[model samples]
Target: MGVWHRSLSRFFSPDEPHAAEPQVDQESNLHLEKPISEPLLKAISTNDLPTLRALLETQDRQLFSQIAQNGTPEAAAYLLSRHTVPEDYSQYIGSADPILHPTQYLIRESARYGNAPLFRYLLTQYPAIFSSQRWNNESILLSAMQGGVGIWRVILDYYPAWKDAEFAGHHGCVLEFLVDRDKKELIEFLLQEGLDTDRAGDPVLELARRRGAGKEVLDLIRKYGG
Candidate 1:
């Protein structure tokens, strides 16, 4: 995984215990006399497309995920739409492994924010972003799965190449995300894709059944599993 890992110290920092968001006001913060790094946050929050573009071009790839987690959802969406790589994208392909560079940046940030516009842009402008790996050894499919139906719909409509939407897993195919939101139609769509009640590829179902998932959730799992 090319993803950057946050320091253990940062994780446990009592002063900044990982607020749900990076900063509230993304616009005014851009002009504050704080620091250079502060602008990145501001640019993201305010949806300053040009500033985000400039920063993404020059920023270190390793810090991509941190930016994703820290940037405002608005700015993240803006930058993701503008991301591009060196002309040698395919040249790097023949190498043993691949690095999608800025495209990966967009994917990570879009996943973090669940921004439909940004995700859709990637699927259109940079189809290659879908192939980029996510953290925890998951694919973009897993990203959408973990993110729930909003993400799922965004990916499905824009990224038709998602052949593994409901691949086999512990729950066969019923362990899809959106448990709290009860994405029943999404589950049914998965079933239409060929995920039967068997354990061929139903991690969602496996998770629900093994954990004694609620009746509605189980019904969803089985409904799709069948």
Candidate 2:
């Protein structure tokens, strides 16, 4: 999850810029950043559930499958309502741009958006979407951390083992960001959830010290085995 700049307009109101990384496929020559053309994408971004339902019913199955693969949680639920999860899973959930796999896209969107109800709904409706064997746990964890404590907690409650998932240097661990922002509560919550304070770039304890973390925050890091 090394940072990549992208527009939020494709997934949200144009006025609201999303923090999630934008993607472009150079080799495949897919312009992912291009304006939204798919009707499903427009419907999902606008929260127009009825139009989404109509599109799902009237469109080609593969078209619905391609769009839904990288859709938001609400859109995913609606897509699932009409279509069964594909048995040859890849057949039902891929696009011209392989980088935007549904599993990763869904996790990134659900976690970074910080919508607890929608996140929970997607999890409940399509638990397999985030199965550790299929999706990157590190990506899920990093994105959840960016989403704040509430979203992180939802995923943690669902998959306790992920609490210990080690982050790669490129995954953009949230500890440094949290310490930089002096977000003590979120830092503490992450520590309590058992995220390792030891990172490749800057260990949480050292970063906190350099950033002049409050006494309470330092104590929390140590208390949680930083």
Candidate 3:
């Protein structure tokens, strides 16, 4: 994020001299100037969730997404509950401009943190963000897997593109990890989705079973042909 130079309005600056001096200060300085949205930066740092909610409610949603990457994301999530996600969320993010902010930060923070309501709002408003196999590799589906089936429900019911993404991300079909560490029902949900066994050579049910997942879950996996 760079400084957004406010262009002088010709109507208001008709008599004001064009900046022949190049607008550079003569005095030498060591400190960098504030970026354009410094106030927004300051507010999020201060955890001013109310103000954040209001500002995001009015600004382009992608700006909010960018802010999420650098700001107090937990507070932002709280604020998101109070605001309505723009119906045009994708339009704000999927720009023709290649330099536009990346969508990963927003998706990772909102979805991975188990902010079910906020995730739901974003999924409904910005389907393209979740239309791929990739979660931020840093936190990834590991979050949703740990969050709960309710969280999965929030994703699936709202994000129509999620199933394909899950498949592409090695098909979020198998619960090969510790089921005891997370709710068992998520495995069942994946099974019902017609998830096949043997995801890229990882035997879906046996992996979890080997890891001490309950026989009950393993049986469900077998029922699903894992």
Candidate 4:
């Protein structure tokens, strides 16, 4: 913890011309670089839930929104659930710029970890988050593929358009993602959804074959004659 504080102090040093004005601790006459905010950020980053809860009791609710910027999926879930509706923090909810907003990071992390509850909560609370895309126009569905099949299904159920969405990668759509990852259930799910794999010159099947997909996957592809 000492190392973390020291490292952060360097960036928030009073000498840094662009640093935000530091707050002074009345009793100790200590110049806190960012006052109570720094500790809250550190606690969230370190996953110190006890410390985070204690700080929250006294800190501003606005700081809770900042957790989405870099906090872990677990931390995001805890903070969001503990706080009331964050209507005041809407400005930082989601952004399309390369610089990731908290909501965008939360979405990506939730999908990456297959945290369906958190993903659902955030989606329900702030549907606008989906309107923004991450790097290379990556959608929440693309990120969810990295997690487990349950999360993938949840996202698909909530946002059907994701099945047809193309991410910035070799895999074009959900079908290709399931094939590449050898997710048989997801593949079957897409098949049931009437995904036409019979296109005469579909590149995904060829790509799947070249990538050494399992026989089951190849057979599924064959069934559709892709």
Candidate 5:
């Protein structure tokens, strides 16, 4: 994972109990003073690329910041097309405490929506941000797990070290998160990826049982000798 791989494109705070997740709504509150036109909001929410392009042509710097905060892969792709992402692209969006970088905001949004292409595109555009030590935290990977097995697989494919990364507080590992959420497919995937079920904090089978997981999940965990 150096500065530029030939496969180029193929690439928070533990305060509140749910701090491991991005407080999207709460964080958005910090940006209330920033003026974003309604049409831009609608285009971002509806993923109307043409409208976004038309609007972005003239808006000030705040435009990209707002897009980074709310837009998806479509908007990201388009924005990246116009601007050469700076090395310090991990910029602060709000001028308040507990501020999160726009890059983090975008990554969380990409993970939440399972937008692997957007994730990869951003990785290629800003390898410095993606490979930075500060960004490789547990909560970010937890967000990817929350996205589902598809994005989880994409993430691990790029950052293999996170295959067994531990999550802080509850849901110690991806295995535990999948079990708690009764994500059968992801459980099977992680088990096959060599996650030791018994070593993933608690006994996988028991945790699944306690979480009222279905027989399929239980059986999969047991098959891996959980």
Candidate 6:
């Protein structure tokens, strides 16, 4: 598993039983260290634009990077208003700190939150960010699938490669991920987008069945069966 997947596995599958105690302790410690200043994070979370603007003016404007990861249109607009030239912006594009890469962070966050306008704005402003990879070389499409069908549609409309991109881990393709999550809308979307839901030896439908997926999922499988 990749670093991101390994770190998240415990929280996502807490009942799996392995080394829970130490992981819990580490998680607690990690949460104690607030990377973003409390006031700024609070302002972003509460959508207090005035407080956010004041914080940016008084505090280090560099802290504005935090808002890019917030996945809110307001935060995105504020960040865009302060856009530097492409030359200067390059410094932040691939920063070692993932959160500092405004475009990449915004793309991932927007996908996760189903914020099409924000995603579109970032794509228009920084098309190069789409070429960047996140954890395990996963594409923005994988992140969008994790959100829902709306996110998938908004991103796939602009970046069709997402449909074919396979995730690094056992999650496999977008179809498999949607099936595992029981995301009926995304499953249908992928099918409509030409995903071979009934490909030979593809266990996606079987897995969904074992998960006790409802009639919607079963009907999708039947409709698309080859």
Best lDDT goes to which candidate? 6
Predicted model with the maximum TM-score = 6
In model 3, which regions exceed 4 Å deviation?
1-110, 131-140, 158-174, 178-182, 198-202
Q: Please give the TM-score that candidate 3 achieves against the real structure.
A: 0.44
Error of 6 at 87 (Å): 9.7
Per-residue lDDT for 66-158 in model 3, tens only?
Answer: 333232333344434444534332333323121233234454554554556555655555565554324332133555665556667776675
Ranking by lDDT: 6, 5, 4, 2, 3, 1
Candidate 1 per-residue C-alpha lDDT over 1-226 given as tens digits, one digit per residue, 9 for 90 to 100: 1111222213222333553323537653442323456677799899999998777545544344444444344444444445454533222221212125555444545554565555565566655544533221244554555455566677556544452444434332233443444655555565565543454444656655665656876776665553
> What is the clash count for each candidate, in the order shown?
17, 0, 0, 1, 1, 0
| C-alpha lDDT values of all predictions | 0.48, 0.56, 0.49, 0.57, 0.58, 0.58
Residue-by-residue lDDT tens digits, candidate 5, 6-104? 112121113323223324585543443345678888999999999997676545234344443334455565545555443253442112111224455
TM-score, one value per model: 0.46, 0.48, 0.44, 0.52, 0.56, 0.57
How many backbone clashes are present in model 2? 0
Candidate 2 displacement at residue 149 in angstroms = 1.3
Q: Tens digit of lDDT per residue, candidate 6, span 1-226? A: 1232233323222232431444357665565432767888899999999998777665423333333333345556555555553332334232323333445556665666566566676777776565544342264665677667766666677777667666665557667667667888888877888776554464666766876778898789778763
Better of 4 and 5 by TM-score: 5
Off by over 4 Å in 5: 1-100, 130-136, 169-171
How would you encode candidate 2's per-residue C-alpha lDDT over 51-164 as one tens digit per residue?
A: 987765444344333333334454454434444433332332312122334433444555665655556666666666566343355555555666677787787788766655
